[model samples]
Target: MKTKTVYCLSGLLLGLLTACQPSDSNLKNQNVALQLQQKALNSTLGYDLVESLTVEVGPRLPGTDKDIQAVNWAVNKLQSLGFDKVYREPVQVPVWHRGQAHAAVTSPYTQSLVITALGGSVATPEEGITADIVRFNSLADLKQAAPESVEGKIVFIDHKTERHQDGHGYGKTAPGRSQGAAAAAQKGAVAIVIRSIGTDSDRLAHTGMMRYQEGIKPIPAAAMSNPDADLINNMLKRSDKVTLQLFLSPESQGTATSYNVIAEVTGSSKPEEIVLIGAHLDSWDEGTGAIDDGAGVGIVTAAAKLIQDLPQKPARTIRVVLYAAEEIGLVGGKAYAKAHQHELHNHYIAAESDFGAGRIYQLDWNVNEAAVNALQQLTVEMADIGVMPGNNEASGGPDVSMLPALGVPVASLRQDGRDYFDWHHTPNDTLDKIDPAALAQNVAAYAQFAWLMAQSEIILRPVAEKQSQ
Candidate 1:
């Protein structure tokens, strides 16, 4: 019996030794760590943050009192979240107020019209301006019209939108809204109105920023609701000599100081290397900016919070930037680029969630070929969260676009934009529009990506000149 026991003990010791081989042990440890990370990220809490932002601070347009309040709210929230550092950087933003917008058909038929001021549009006089309405089937037609034909007339360029996942209709139909003022001014038109570039058939109008050329006259511009646009079209179909009146009091009220809210979670190992997550702080003034960016604020902050809660610190730092005035010509993005130009090389990856709180369907990236394999691996890890590989031509969000010039690699978690344009920049944008499950999924994806990127041995691509050397 003693001899049998000795033999059994020796066999057990040999088996243990084989199992403890370095490579096998490392693999076991890796699998265990991965499981822990997955568990930590599984109970994502993005909805809590998003709900807090949408319900608490709401509608943070730049230069407005609400915008300032939002900055204060974000600062307090970040500090409460246990971020290592939370601060605000001031950005001098253009202040344009939409006082009141009114329009009506005077000649062919008398009826009221619903309209909203286009961003950056100059206000019309108090009494408003009445002029003969000229109809243009498209931008090309407006451009070819005789100057005298459009002089002192309100130009209407009616172009319909078609739906696509990428919001391609916006690109195809934007010429009317973006250049209508300048194109009409060049043709001697007084003011311009275009059909809202949205796929929805509802009466709500979508408003966005519009630019006038340097030398051209800056005229009042506005977008009419789809139904109202139909009314105008119906009137024009009967006669080309319809008369219209427009009254908009949108004005530039000098200058105001808006701020971008920033926070950081320090890393244990490579502290200098940085991963950035961002969302726009400023929203359009019409409605609460819930879907547009409140969802974004929720997503990034929750991701950071999850990382902070981890037992071990990530290998690299994570920065959360809530940009200001993204709605008005990327004012905050440009300011951030200029302010952080020196640290661009340190940015390992930057991403922003600006689209509505729809489910994230795809992930795009803008990094060198070397980064693809790593991102592909990341995609597989996030597959349960419904994230798929997307186009590599990632331009990033409006705010994140500024980072690439500094050679910062970008990651894109593309959300489902199927219904984004419906409530985007419209008065209907509210907290109820967000899906709690979808928001939580977003948090899960962001948390996992940020954590793995921070912890991974593989150095991400777009390694700046300074880092590579």
Candidate 2:
């Protein structure tokens, strides 16, 4: 009896060893394939894409001629790049034109100040508005001020944005830009000006979206360049009352047609399942939108192009979506969610590259708890490229925020955004701001992860209750 038991144990041990050998060999093969793919993506394709978008189709503000040109360009470029299917989905976008903007200190000190109208801001009268300046250290201060004190005054919300690699400072300071006008309007201020939500101290004022609440009347809102804000602060130190003249001729031209450009590399097996990668196509009219989102379009497109060049198709389709009108409030993203409500469940994974051309340092996911192991393995594979794992609380990007909210798994390849806001919405956001080598790294990282997700059979969706137990 003892001899028979010993023989059975030996057989079981041999079988287990044989099973582990193939698993190890398969892992080694996967690593080799990933490395080769990464090497191939470290090329000039990403930079060239950015250059083409910026130079050929400059400033693609939604609903404008340039916006239509950009959509057409994207469709042609994607088709030329060998995408199996390239198409455009129509989206309705609000058109706001920035005509002429100017500001000057009138009393106590006379100096021209650099300013840009915030998106959705109402225009001042033809003669413009000249009023005594009332300064608040921050939005909180402005909110606490009495209506009588703020009435008949140009309220300046002076909140300075800090620089950080993760860009948390923008969120901290951006409230003053987005809601400051409404808050000040509630306090009876004639207009509102906030220090630009930027990291640089340059004279370029960043322009972004601001909202007016339903009940509160819209007011003229603008962002003063950091240096100009400093000038205003310095002048206020010497005198109790400072006056300023402000003029902006921006106007809303009602609704206009825009498009979301989509291209796909169809899957060999589960073609219905999707791995979606996205970037916003529309940019602020201030610059070429290179660092703000042209880099993003470049990175994702280049990555998808590399995947399409692979010898065999991946298991799931890889779809690249170029969103429209992201600067004003994710107009394209919301439209997409509403249009594709039924298919949202099949979106296996989604990610967006909108930060800049900065090198990726961290990867965060909003995937199911069951897929944590798959994400951990991906991080291990990405460690060679300097990408570390981050917490699971990921927002993806501005354009794809709705995906995570709908329970579609999303990932965030966080870039070093230390200097992104400095050139974000200003004329400084040109192709010169992107580093070719950094852009290549971004492509490599995105390609590797996107390819892995496309090929793997890992279930990224949340497990059912019965399956979890």
Per-prediction tally of clashes: 0, 0
Per-model TM-score versus the true fold: 0.89, 0.93
Tell how far residue 256 is off in model 2, in angstroms.
0.8
Measured with C-alpha atoms, the lDDT of residue 186 in candidate 2 is 94
Give the per-residue Cα lDDT of candidate 1 at 344: 82
Q: Candidate 2: which stretches are off by over 4 Å? A: 1-29, 463-469
**Backbone clash tally for model 1?**
0
1-469, model 2: which lDDT tens digit per residue? 0111000011122213111222443354355446645664558998999999999999988889999999998999999999999999999999989989999999998999999999999999999999999998889899898899999899998899999999999998999999999999998899998999999989999999999999988889999999999999899889999999999999999989999999999998889988999999989999998997999999999998888887778788999999989988999999988988899899988899999999999888876655554556544656667888786677788878877767688889999999998899999999999999889889988888787777654556662232222
Decoy 2 TM-score against native: 0.93
User: At residue 113, what lDDT does model 2 achieve?
Assistant: 96
| Residue 211 shift from truth in candidate 2, angstroms | 0.5
Q: List the residue pairs that clash in candidate 1.
A: none
- What tens digits encode model 1's per-residue C-alpha lDDT throughout 1-469? 0111000011122213111222443333234334433553565456677667767777777898989988988999999889988999999998888888999999889999988989889988889989988877778888889999899988887888877776667778878887889999887888999888777778887788888989888889999998998998888779877888999998888879999899988988889989998999889977788888888998888888877877777778989999999998899888988898888888888899898888777888777655555456544546656788775677678798767657888877888888888888888888888877777777777776787667554445553333222
Output the lDDT of residue 298, model 1.
87
